[model samples]
Target: MAGLLQRVKSKMAIFAHRKARGMLDGEYGSVFRGRSLDFDDLRAYVPGDEVRDIDWKASARHGSPLIKRYVAVRRQTVLLVTDTGRNMAAEARSGEVKKDIAVLALGVLGYLAHRHGDLVGLVCGDSAATRSLPAKGGEAHLERLLKHVDSHANLEAAASRIQDQLHHVARNVKGRHLLFVVADEIAADAATGQLLRRLRAQHEILWLTVRDAELAPSRQAGTDPIARGDSFSVADSTFLAWQPATSAAVQAAYTKATAERDAARKAMLRGAGITEGEVAGSADVITGLFALLERHRRAG
Candidate 1:
């Protein structure tokens, strides 16, 4: 498992490096200037405009033209919050776990934001929160953030809640920023809804939902149960299983329950005014993420 994780990290680093380079080259609509703009485009001097911005040399060269110079704007910060709760460990089908997908998504976003000259921070939590890294800029900062995410191995306790931690995050972030959340689309309780509403008013919030295909379909039909002699590992130890469910009806019931859960989760996310991207295992995270960013950029 450790080796697999290392391989995933290496691949992600290469992808992020390439993506960040393209972004830094100033793609159309990319935020080159920060949120606070000191300067804008040069335009012909108007009668009411301030005289200090006029470019005398350009005006002389143009004979009758009046040129005004503008300064660049301040940049916006981006915060990425990832849930490392036990729920994230849930398997989807026979592929990568939700936790793995979340890590990759966060890594890409962190790199992209850093490349775009946005200060980036990470908040990891379940019921309680841990601030792994504060908002900072540059490639070195991004690399450090990725390393922290990679070294994170602890899982949240069962029944851990996210609402309180989210609220805390909202309060601690001093300025308006882009908040990207990676988690499962679990039902949003009242507290969760309130926290989201408060944060949305001040920041642009995007939700990346990691889900297992098996959880969506809810059934494993026609698969033979493991025999008594078969061994499997739970936690860090191997153990033999005496029996496993093999009934088709049982699988069908599980499937129905999972479908209902997924529906409810989607509805809840919509109500919270958050757009969700569902990811299963290592399925094309970059494509979905890029599409979302493009949509947001267009809208802004």
Candidate 2:
């Protein structure tokens, strides 16, 4: 476990570097959630109070300076929910399986949680079954959590159960925490949206979608047909068939449908107040994680 932690954290060393803001060192907010200060309330200004906390306008209205008080809640819970269905087991353009990419993303964030003194947990499984590690803080505990996620136990499910995992987390988790939902491209099923809405109302959610090159057929013009003897891909694999669209018009229609689907998915996610991070099949996990943290840092 120590060795695995060292290996994965080494890959993320760039992200964990000391910055002027010193977020990782806790001088400012930890990288997970922006600033660490949680606003408590306003009160009469007292001597020795930090000038930045004074609400000048409020003080003018009330004829006295007021200071904003913040209580520190240093520890946070970061729960990772990963989909382990067979689709994730398929090869990515990088030649690594989508599941492996998903695990890399998980490790990057899990280690970040540990760095920030946050409790990390895992909820990984597919349609068949699920396993969870209760949120705990520690290098050893985090390594264990990562190991559980890296296991094949959840990857053997016969079908995708992303929605099932979402539902489980929504029902089981309580209070404010960070939830990372890792899956292939967003299918945006009805239940998924509804469950996400409910979960967002409780926990802060970030969606990390792993995209294998094969997911987008239009981009695979240079790639071979689905298979030599097979016209249609296997039920669980990429659905693209070797045959081209019946006609130019049919191809155009398919393209339009695909575009519309992508647009709708983005719109739905926006409405849910959830920002998404996408990692290419072959992209470096550390680089992908830095991009996600930058976006999150700005937004938070």
Expressed as tens digits, the lDDT of each residue in 14-77 for candidate 1 is 5557765355234312533233344455667778776765778878887755755556545667
- TM-score of candidate 1 relative to the true fold: 0.66
Q: lDDT tens string, model 2, 1-300?
A: 346577676655654555622443342133444334578889998899889889898899999999988887779888989887776776555767787688768876777777777888888877777777899888888778666656653335467677878878877777778888888666666666777788878777777877654332333444455433323332344455535644567668866876787677777776787777777753566655556566655665
Instruction: List the global CA lDDT of all models.
Output: 0.62, 0.69
Give all candidate RMSDs, comma-separated.
8.8, 5.5
Please give the distance, in angstroms, between residue 136's alpha carbon in candidate 2 and its true position after superposition.
Answer: 1.3
The list of candidate 1 runs beyond 4 A from truth reads 1-72, 155-160, 213-245, 297-300
Candidate 2, position 109, lDDT: 76
Deviation of model 1 at 90, angstroms: 3.9
Candidate with top lDDT is 2
